[model samples]
Target: MEINDLTAAESRVWRAFHKGEPVAFGEGEAENPATGSDWGPERTVRASVLRALLLSTPQVDGEIPRLRLSGARVTGQLNLMYAVVDHPLHLRYCHFEESPDFYGSRLRQLNLRSSVLPSVSLASTRIDGPLRMTDCRVRGPVKLAGSQIAGALFMDGADITTSDPSVPVIQLHQSVLSDGFAAPGLRVRGEIRLDGATVGGSVNLEGAELSNPGGNALRAQSLEVRADIRARRLRAEGGVDLRGARIAGRLDLMRSRLSNPGGMALRASSCVIGELWLFRSEPLEGTLHLRRSRIDVLSFEPEVAPGEVLFNNLTYTALTPHEPADRRLPLLERDGDGYVPYAYEQLAAAYRHVGDEGAARRVQLAKQRRHRATLPWLGRVWGHLQDTTVGYGFRPLRAAVWLLSLLAAGSIVYALHHPRPLKAAEAPEFNPVFYTLDLLLPVISFGQEGAFAPTGGYQFLSYALILTGWILATTVIAGVSRSVTRQ
Candidate 1:
């Protein structure tokens, strides 16, 4: 406001503000008309404003003036904190010696494209319009915690960094954005935090580099995005945490590389989302935890290794049928240590809901096979025996086949040997077929096996037949019960 403190360029802007015309900092280019050695030239202007110029700057003819700092280098610390700025601040190809403080300020619009700055801290601020900082070079951290933006926020191809790379370079904790937040090809040296943030529009972070080795590269817990949150081709060195976040649209992580072995690359526990597309050429490395999450469609066509992702209690409503579930069965095929029966069951049910019974039964059968494989040596043998004998009590007719075989062997042996009859009183009356049936049927008291008195190997043979009959009967009963219960 003081005349003595105002530089030559600031004086021109002050005059322009009084006359209500378009205003800007620095100077415009001129022809080579002045030639003087005594007076040198100044390329960029340097000035400082102590007070807020909120109402003093008038709009000429009811039209806002452009404050273009085209190819200008702004000097000194611009303290516009908590100040209501209405005009559009467009600073292009400029350099700021000190970072501006815009805390809790209501700005109409702000543009800092292709510029360099120390840092940008707009915590708890409210912006009424768009914020464009494309391809800018920010040296320090950019913090926008608890801020609200009415329009889109763009930082595409921007080079944002800090001295310490471990710290979060871009923070938007608990902020709300009316439009999309895009940052394609952004190279940030540290983590990007969007914890508890809500975006009404989509968020596109394609080809962005988020690196914070061994820690979270992007912590967006409980974030609610109304639209899609796409990060295709994202190369995250550290892990990306999205625990309990909800996305209305697709969560497409196709071709993205997230690596954090033995730890979570992306922990999305209990998140409710739409279709999840993860079809990638390279195998997804790390533990992708999706426990208790519900997704409409799961397109996991990646070549994931065992223990690479933990799908404990993950449930999906639908599965996109890109190929037959046979070839795509590898998604559920994991190592013995990482086998989850419920997860398999959930997938099977999803397949069944889509009327793909073949795929459903395949998943169920796989669950059984993998489960048996994970057991001890004795258990696997028992399972195999049950499967062959009665099909794990799923096929009761197998028991009848064993019984008939036993009967035939007994009759053949008796007919060929012509063993002594049961009483020896009526040897001719004793029928070999009747005798075999008596030994085989435990419930029927035919009086042949009881009355018969045989010695040597024949006596042992009768006892074996009785034991075999009893075992077969028990197996049949079990098989019936199992079949009914499954139905």
Candidate 2:
């Protein structure tokens, strides 16, 4: 490009690039009225001239060749597909007539802070330094899929909206960032996909509002983050998918409002996270599916108990709030998958880990009750008998109480009417207490049950006592065996 062909603004930009200076047409404020739409050729720079300067211009010996233009109106599409730009590009507070295409480009650094563009395509692009688009507003998608950034990606306070509902507003799938992705206070009207992405540092998404109704607001399946994911107070309308995501640090969703009606609000199944902080101010409006996921610590203290949850096979070492088993049992009861023994067993193990043996037993007891509900009618009836008689082997004192009550009743009945002796020569004494003990104790014989025989009503009474003793003995043995097997 010849210097004589440059427009007034383009000439200033060209000179500034060679001299390593930023061309500022208006106040640095993003909403400065001087940089409004009424600007003429004096503030306009053609994209072709800017591209030429970045690609063909020779670098000065003493200065860096950078395109640092601010508060300017770019007229054409700055297509730099597959271009390798060594200079840092900074286009702050600028307005673009067409979206810039940087697909497969390798750049030293890229900053579009507070700029307004129709869209941006940086798919498969590689950045040596940070990619900063803080406070920028894009009307269409910002494609960054398969991109590799050596530095952090910042989009703080940016508003990225899209008319197309099927596509994501910001695509970071398969992207790798060394310093992580920060997007606090971001407002996105479509999905932000980070599937298969790897972030070296933490992801900070505080106070972001993502609205893609009836679809995924944030789809981050299989994302591997070396650090934490701080998403406190995030308001997502559609849902969030963190399935198979592996985070080294905490995934904090404290005070976040996630709603998708009947659908799952957060699907984090098969994930391996260090800690999950879900202490919300309000209850989750939809189901939270964490099936087959493993976490170190689960902080689940919601203001209201969640209604639907799918936590089958979820394994967590610890639980927050240190609540009793009763308080935590409600959460297991709300499992949408229904009668998941693994979930209950995991909770019991968690309680045991904290040295809460009583709570652990309570959890196991609840597990039995939950499992009983799914059994057949006869099985349930038998379960009820075991529950009432022995508290399903959890409360051993109940068995003792039943034994003592039956023993007392038998002793009183036999004391009122003594049975005839089988042989007068062999009979010792008719002690009702000893006789009742001999009848109840199935394993041992006191030599009195065989020595004596009952007649008429006494015979009927003896038969009833024998039957009752056998039933109680059989139930006790069954309960003991079940408890032993579980241990």
> After aligning candidate 1 to the native by TM-score, how far in Å is the CA of 262 from where it should be?
4.0
Error of 2 at 167 (Å): 1.3
**Full-model lDDT, candidate 1:** 0.73
Cα RMSD to the true fold for all candidates: 5.6, 1.9
Model 1 C-alpha lDDT per residue in residues 271-343, reported as the tens digit of each score = 9899777777246567777888989888766454335556777888876644576765575675223787887
- lDDT, candidate 2, at 335: 81
Measured with C-alpha atoms, the lDDT of residue 123 in candidate 1 is 85
lDDT tens string, model 2, 376-409? 9999997887778777777888878887887788
Colliding residue pairs in candidate 2: none
lDDT of each: 0.73, 0.88
Which stretch of 10 consecutive residues in model 1 shows the poorest summed lDDT? Answer: 31-40
Clashes of 2: 0
Q: Estimate each model's TM-score.
A: 0.80, 0.95
Q: For candidate 2, what's the RMSD?
A: 1.9
Predicted model with the maximum lDDT: 2
Candidate 1 runs further than 4 Å off: 2-5, 11-61, 305-307, 320-339, 369-384, 390-487
* Candidate 2 Cα misplacement greater than 4 A, ranges: 30-35, 302-305, 482-487
